[model samples]
Target chain A: MIPIKKQYRRLRSLLFALSSVIMFFIFWELIALYSPSPYVPDPYSVLKAFITMLTVGDIDGYTLTWHALVSLERVLLGFIVGAATGVPIGMLLGIKPTLKGAVTPIIEPLRFIPPIAWIPLSIVLLIGLWRYIFLIWIGVFFPVLLDTIAGVKRTSITLIQMAKTFGADNKKIIARVIFPSSLPEIMNGLRVGLGVGWMCIVAAEMIGGEPVGLGRLILKYANLLQIDVVIVGMITIGLIGLTLNYFILLLEKRLFKWRVEIRA
Target chain B: MKKAILLESVSKKYEVGSSSLEVIKSLTFDVNENEFVCIVGPSGCGKTTLLRLVSGLEPPTSGRILIFGDPPDPRKQRFGVIFQEDSLLPWRTVIGNVKFGLELQGYKESEHEKIARTYIELVGLQGFENYYPHQISGGMKKRVAIARALAINPDLILMDEPFADLDAQTRSLMQRELLNIWSKLNKTVLFITHNVEEAVFLAQRVFVLTKRPSRVKQIINIDLPYPRARLSPPFISYRERILTAFHEELEGI
Candidate 1:
């Protein structure tokens, strides 16, 4: 059983979070009441729009769920492709300093350019699903690559020495020692990569190739000046992002149970 | 007895910025098969550098190191080395850590598990085979390190103050345990330490080393039998002799 004081603290934090969310809605409603512009809808109207879009189909005969699913599929595919390519390239660069040095100039410039900046280029060079995948891939790739490199670089020297003493050569040391040691860092990269990939969905869907994504739904409703419908789409995106982030965090905890956090 | 390890005029120097800093100054020694030798020195006296040279982790600036009539090369030779710091892989469990060396040496997975289990039991960590490095105590982690080293069945084992980080009680307990393992296995050991008492208690012969630019100042034979008493007159005298050599080196005498 948890201590009484700890339980009390948990309850208090829960209440604070609930109150904060309630206060945000009240403040938003007040803004809608006093606003001269019709773009800011009240929280209640947005909630109604969400329920209607969930139960009955929207103007495109597709529910909000279908749009969110489309967005999720794009994010998942992009994130997987990013990780598959990033990990091997990152490991190669990490192991060979000369290779990293030669490639750094080119990758450095590309990494700084955001996914949104690549929109026009991707649209012109790619078609349909590939366009969205390319944009999201751009957002996901760099973080995974950088994190994997950091992980490989940060492996304990003592552990490497220990492996060497046991008649392990360079290849064996990398596979057995460096790889396992770098896993926690690699997992962090995947988590960050997924978050960035999800964020790219909006810009990806807005390219006009895909018409059923949450981002497209939001854009369509906004064009018709149905502010409540747009707000509903916005809330759905926020919820999905939160869920995705939390899912990866849970996976990290499960995979690395040996990790001891030195919390004060 | 055959010479398990032979070092002739081994010296190591570091190039720090522009000026060179000498750490080891022409060290020469030999450790025989089944012998337990301890090198005692002041801190930062290149004792670790000596061990590194022996394990072939680093090369000496000059002189030659031979293990069983061959030059020591970690990639080719089977040498067991436990470092001064914690080196057990945190991602691996006790058994997994022990099996790591075996796996790298190309032993089949089915064959290595039993071998790993034997070493785990030998180190008195049988119950904690499934426990990770973080789950075990300092002494236990040290045991896992020992087991990992021993699992490779190396003829020469080098330890760099393996119990230096333990508490006083745990350090002594580990010292006794180490003696037990060393005697039972009958393997050659070249252990490095700063504690004169620890050196006297564990070694068949204690080699006293001086401060930085360190060289072997004295080699005192410890003729006391197994389970040597720390409080005994002979043990105290051996400890004092090594301590005097260290103190004289510190005083520049």
Candidate 2:
């Protein structure tokens, strides 16, 4: 049970956040009223559009929910593949300096190129979903890879020494000590990678000739001067990104409870 | 009595920049089976280095270190080492940390919890078995380290000022607890500490060392029985002797 003082503090913070959001919508409504621009839809119009997109089918041959689901699927698949491959490669490079030296020169250059920048080449190389996946994978890969490597490198020497003195072989040491020790950093990597992947998926969908994705819907509606639908798409993307980040944070809290308690 | 460890002319030198610094200079000592021995020296006297060399964590520049009539190899003969640092795995609970050595040894999964719990209880941490290292006090964390070490059931234990981080009262309490456990287990122990009183209180024999490039200065035997009184005449006299030997080295420097 929370104390009254703590409960009051939490309630105050919540009210503060809610008021700021309400003020933002009011400011946006006032701008819409004064400007009378078709491009800048009012908050109420966007909300109505959001509900219409939710209930009605055939916005762009599919409902808004379908478009959001398709985008989420692509991002999820791309992020999973990126993490699965990147973590192992990163662990290998972290443990084996010679291999890192050999591969770093190749990867270092590729890391600088933004994922959205790869859309043209990805389209030429692949078709439809694969192109979007490729772009999303590129977006997710580098952060996870670099962070995993850094985490592995930062494992405490004392922990490693302790493992070794207990007669642990190289494999056991990595599995038991280094991997668990590097988890917080790896989780950070995944969080950052997922955020990048979300953005890349939206950008990729806008140009990848995809018919049913939130990004494609926004692009289509904007071309037709349906500003409310476009705003709905934009808001959906933000909400989904926020939800994904919250899920990752929840996982981190569960897994690294010891770490959290230590900081507290 | 059987000899548990024998170090002959062990020397360790570290190469800093271009010049090499000798840390342990031709140090020679032997610890018997089931004996509790402490090495007391001034702070930063290469005492930890000596333990590291003995444990084969680091190699000596020159000398022979034998454990039970063989060269010291962690794989060949297990030696539980408790470092000055808590060294508890933050992610693991008390029982989990205690079971770590057993897991590395590839013991049966079924046996781990039981064995770990036994040691945890032995270290007076029965109720805190599921508590993570971060959740425990410094003294409790040290107890976890001890439990982890003892759970391995190693041939010998090498401790490097394991209680040095605790407060004076907690340090004395832990020393007593350690003595209780050691007597019951009859484990061979080589403890390193800068505290002269701690050395005399816990050890059957105390080896005093010089300040830097440390060599064995003297070995004093504490003839007092177990459950030694802190204020007793013999205990005080032994403590004084070790203190004087330690101060002489400091003064010479």
Candidate closest to the true structure, highest DockQ: 1
Q: Give per-residue CA lDDT, model 1, range B37-93, as digits (tens).
A: 999988889998899899988888999888988888876778889988999898888
Give all candidates' CA lDDT scores.
0.90, 0.89
Which sections of candidate 2 miss by over 4 Å?
Answer: A1-7, A57-59, A96-109, A262-264
For all candidates, state DockQ relative to the true structure. 0.78, 0.69
- Give interface RMSD, every candidate, in order: 1.1, 1.0
Candidate 1 per-residue lDDT over residues A38-154, each given as its tens digit: 788899889899999998968978899999998999999999999999888888898888999999999999999988889899978998888888999998999999999999999
lDDT of 2 by residue, A24-138 (tens): 9999999998885657889998889888888894455588889899999999989999899889888999999899999989999999998778878887899867887788899
Docking class of 1: medium
Regions more than 4 Å wrong, model 1? A1-9, A97-109, A262-264
Q: After superposition, how far is residue A120 of candidate 2 from its true place, in Å?
A: 2.2
| lDDT, residue A247, candidate 2 | 98
